[model samples]
Target: MRLAGAIDIGGSSTKLGIVAEDGSIIRRDSVPTSLHGEPMVVVDAIVASLQPMLDAGGTEGKPVSGIGVSVAGFLNRDHSAMVHNANLPALHDFPLRQSLKERLGFDCRLEVDSNAAVVAEYQYGAGRGSARLLGVTMGTGLGGGVIIDGKLLRFTGECAGDLGHIIVDHKGRLCTCGARGCLEAMVNSASLSERAGGRAVREIITSAREGDQLAMTALAETGWWLGLGLASLSPIFSPDRIVVGGGIAAAGELILEATRASYRTHARPEFREKTQVVGSSFEGWEGIVGAASQFLNPIA
Candidate 1:
């Protein structure tokens, strides 16, 4: 069976994996992202970590067809380089695809991390049959992707699906992107932690599960913001399904119930009954899976 090599580069760490056609990760590893070093240094580290897995495939007689990289940044129109990334300063305008291809001797494809994840959902997860799907990843910030008519939507400068910066409030919380009341500012993990009196999100989730009123309220508030954001998008996209992912989504109904309620309260009556919100099918590895799939079937 043919395989694909996948890399998901996040703010804190980078994940490397060899994936089968069915979205199963046959082998995986990770390394901390060296933000202060040159971009090539980080790429070299990833290659070192993945070398073993690549060699193992030789013995198994499964040659990797290509490598796909999912990056948490904006990609140039051609997708050969990262134009900007707040989390990894060293990677700004970096020629990621060329560097990887030179070092790994395989065709390499680069994609925005959120877009990759949404592709994973649309192709293999909860969004398998939806005509229009909106996938959201809630973590340090909100990231989004849209798939319509069985194709990924692309906009000017490749910025079509950046739903995080949508202004949800005019005079609400400040966002890292220098915007006021962005959906990301209102519903990110940092805001949730702040709502829980500076406790970690994990602690708040644990407390909420233990019947702590404050913790539950905090999650509910975040969900409210998330729902309002979804409501705002519903009229424009009219997505049939919205899949929420990332670490924070693990809270399940503690947060999702409030999200549903808020969406119902704010969405148009016509849309209210049509749209459905659900958690991700893949845990935290959707980006990796999607990256691998990109190699098998390149989206146009």
Candidate 2:
């Protein structure tokens, strides 16, 4: 089987895997991202974790063809390095593509994380067969991407414009981007944690699942903001399907049900009738899956 190496670097953790051409992740693992460490810290961790899998490819009759790296930031025009993201400062302007290629000895491609997520959904997961698709990821910050008729929308920052920065509440929270009431400000991990009395996202999800009212409330509030944001964004993209993924989406229906309800409540009548909001099947792994698609079925 044809294979590719995939790495997804987020603000909190880094996931790496070997993915088959059919989009099945053959092997997968994750490591904590050193947000405060130097750039090589991540590069080294990825090499140590993924090299063995890549090596075994040949013996397993699945020799890897290429490597794809997805970073949670804006990439340079060449897609060589992450250039802009307040949360992942360590990788800012770091030559991530070159560093990985030199150590791993494979052709490497870099992609914006949000773009990668949407690409994966379109190719293999929730967005399959949809002519117009929109994907949103929730974590340290919110992100979005768009795909239309099998082609990615690349008009903005290698993905859809910062869909998170759109103001959903002009009087809500202040965002890291120095804006007030940005959708991201209201719906990100930190915001959710604050709303849940300082519980981490994992803790909140677990608690909510076990019937914790406080935790459920936090997730509901976050989902409400997310749904409102999507509604505000729908008119611009008008996607047939919208997929929500990332760390926060692990709340599953706890959040998505609220999101679905709020989206319908606020979305324009035209969008309410047609746009579908659903959770990602990949959970939090969509980024790496899409990254691996660089070799399996390139998006750009």
The candidate scoring highest on TM-score is 2
Top lDDT hit: 2
lDDT of 1 by residue, 146-229 (tens): 888978877733645568889999998998787799998999888999999999777898999999999999999999999999
- TM-score per prediction, in order, is 0.92, 0.97
Off by over 4 Å in 1: none
Residue pairs clashing in model 1 are none
lDDT tens string, model 2, 1-300?
A: 788999999989999999988999999999999997899988889899999998888687878889988899888888988888888899988888889999999999999999999999999999999999999999989999999888888767677778889998889998989989999999999999999999899999999999999999999999998999999999999999999999999899999999999999999999999999999989799999999998899975
Clashing residue pairs in candidate 2 (N, C-alpha, C atoms within 3 angstroms): none
Clashes of each: 0, 0
